[model samples]
Target: MGGERGSIVHRITKRVSQEIEEDPNLVLINKKNADQADYLIGGGITSFDTYIDREKKDNRKYCTKGVFVSIRYQLVDVKTKEIVYTEERYIDRQDTREGSAPHAIAVVSDDIDMLAKQIVDITRPHEVKVTERIYLVETKNKDFKTACKLAKKSENRRKAQELFAKVYADEGSYQTGYNSAVLLFLNRDFEKAMEEMQAIEEKFHTKEAQKALKRIQEEIEYQQKPVQETSLDSMYLRF
Candidate 1:
């Protein structure tokens, strides 16, 4: 809510209402106009922060350019006062050309609007595409091919993981090793994935291997975080 004349809260509310009105199953009547409704959605921006960095030329400060906008939001049922969703999002952009502080602030405001659109997408129904890969080692061994095929299937993950491990041990193909690590990651075996990727990094040291290793390390760190309870009380108390 703490924004310029084009407030983030107003932008988000207008966009969400427009999107909901387009849905055949939903209607958006103003609170004052409607006497009663089946449900009410209510929430506001909890926090809005912006950062701008000034460019430096030969140790002398030049013009401002880079900007970052972070916002925390929540959605709640007005009748029950229960929070249905909450999230914090950040957007950043940089421009090398000389610009004033107001120019950088304007860029950040645009980014906030874009972030609001993304939040609206989350509240609406949409389809998402999932991409996956299975490595194919150049070999005549039919068992290895079968394992690769099985590994691509969601239901046979465990069996496929065991088979891929066996293939990695026998063939010692860097491709197979990478595939094995990927399978371990998909199965939530982060430690094994890290070990396999680390081995690959030591021997091959390929860019692909390094990236995968970094990704697996991040996943391991994320999994180690403690789970927290989600409730309206927490949402209201946070700000």
Candidate 2:
């Protein structure tokens, strides 16, 4: 490393190591801790993929190498026994070195580190958002048939109205807001989704609500960079 390395140098290494460690540890820990704690935990990586590009120097040229890795994961907590996390991590590793093998490794490693850190930053929050989403979905699905039946077949119209109202009025209202925000987020409407979330904060100041909203916002911002690339791909597909 040169000149004690820059701040980013440390970041790069710390990130890669952290990702490597956390990726595996989450699975083992969640499995081990599932029954013992107040919360049941489950985490696993379903898939991992990597891409690399290399340009060789002509003995007189500069070369650059880049790697991108994506990790897919799902995690659940037991007390609720609900999926609390679903997220993907994307990392980019890049190196620009003349012709040295050591320099090449250093560059690639540094890039991996940088990418891994980015992955962590993006994924952790996304996990929280997804978990909240799952909770909301579960709530909505729990009494659907009963609620619909009461709404449709109650002998007293007034009673049916009341039952229907009671059943569906606030069912997952908070989750609906959060879920709408998630769709907006996927559509790349970050600002509006955030504003929608702000209203949730104003209305329900619960810690869970706040945490859920915060997690969604963080993931939206984290994934924005990739969305740009995704947009380009979509355009190509359209053509």
Candidate 3:
């Protein structure tokens, strides 16, 4: 694969080899050595954007710089020459340096390294951590308390969301409404979460409700975006 950054092609080749070496099911070899292999992986840097402070505070001195790199990759059947998988991913890194624009751009090697690792991760997926909050029941109702316990077990998220919504509707407690919103978020219902949080904020006017509303709104915006499976051509056109 090729990239606009100096030595990026070499870095990518080295990084890919390193990643393959770490996987027990994969092996890295040259094209000539792939006669017995089942699949071939290939692709290149499809888009790149590097920038130094275009606006000069004094005599063209730059205070900020960054790079955005996008790479496209695919896995194909070596025998049939049929494409099996394709992906395009983008990485952006930026920093501030009190120096000339050229000097600022020279310190982007770390960004390139990070981009290379990201590409490797796309090829070999990595494990990520997910955080889940424990919702406490404030009501004296025995049934609501039992449902909260079931919700914490994660066996039935949809049922938990519905139960919490019912509790909030019957009790009209701000805490119950907040719990319902949290369950809605866990269920991947961003719009409903936002609605619940907004209602809580408007009625209670408390700092906690306002903060929760803000977080839910941010999650809603993130879910609405089309960043996943983006294309290099579309990214370039948008930029």
Candidate 4:
């Protein structure tokens, strides 16, 4: 868990471990016997890029500061010795607080939680399934104007409506399609995932959609088979 911004990353990791400890559902194995665990989720902040500029208000300099922490990690399968997942992300925070550790944490707490959940979800994917399903259902039924109003009035009715929403056949809207594409990309189906992303880009015309398109395209290109180089000796000499 060492990195350029080692201390902050360590703090975030410690907090995440504390969360896992407090959570009833997660089974955290002892470090000594981590090899016996089914999967390993590990990450640390690789770099912290920060900037500050003065904003003059009332003839006084007020600094507008920001930091982008690039976190990198890999998930490995204990039994198979396979790298199941890897990700690099930049978590950005913009705040009035200057270059101080306490201020950094204050500005980035939410971002830390969000990123921590991502790693934790990899550690405990099953726990996130229900949450993902709920999100998907909400996405589907979000445009139901009158129905959404009525459903919000009663908890039971809302739950029932959500359940009913899940049963509807998906017409595959933008969010749903993007989610599906991401799942495919995660599963290493890059070609189909790229197709889905392209379709989304054509429809949404958003920067996020364009980013997804770029990522999948990069993955696809990177995964293509490389041409073996031939040395002069190999070309001239007989085996």
What would the TM-scores of all predictions be?
0.47, 0.32, 0.43, 0.55
| Winner on lDDT (3 vs 4) | 3
Across residues 1-239, which tens digit of lDDT does each residue of candidate 1 receive? 24442354565556556555655655665556433443444444434444456666876665545555555555544455543444466656665444455554455556655664555443442321113356766678776788777766656766877777787798787877787787787666779889988998999989888888887786676445443432111111100
Better by lDDT, candidate 3 or 1: 3
lDDT of 1 at 163: 77
Highest lDDT against the true fold, candidate:
3
Indicate whether candidate 2 or candidate 3 has the larger lDDT.
Answer: 3
Q: In candidate 3, where is summed lDDT lowest over 10 consecutive residues?
A: 230-239
By lDDT, is 1 or 2 better?
Answer: 1
Stretches of model 2 off by over 4 angstroms after superposition:
1-34, 37-62, 100-239
Instruction: Report lDDT per candidate.
Output: 0.59, 0.42, 0.59, 0.56
Cα lDDT tens digits, model 4, 65-138, are 67788776556566765556556778888887334333465567788877766666655543333221112345
Candidate 1 segments exceeding 4 Å error: 1-133, 228-239
lDDT of 1 at 8: 48
**Model 1 steric clash total:** 0
Tens digits of per-residue lDDT, candidate 2, 1-239, equal 23212333344444544554566433222333435433221122222323334455565554565544443433333455443334554545566656532233354554555545554443343342222332223434534334333323223223333333344356636544444444444334567767766776777676765775776677665544321111000100000
lDDT leaderboard ranking: 3, 1, 4, 2
- Cα lDDT tens digits for candidate 3, 138-207: 7687657866765764446567667777877888877667777777765667788888888888998987
TM-score of 2: 0.32
Better of 2 and 4 by lDDT: 4
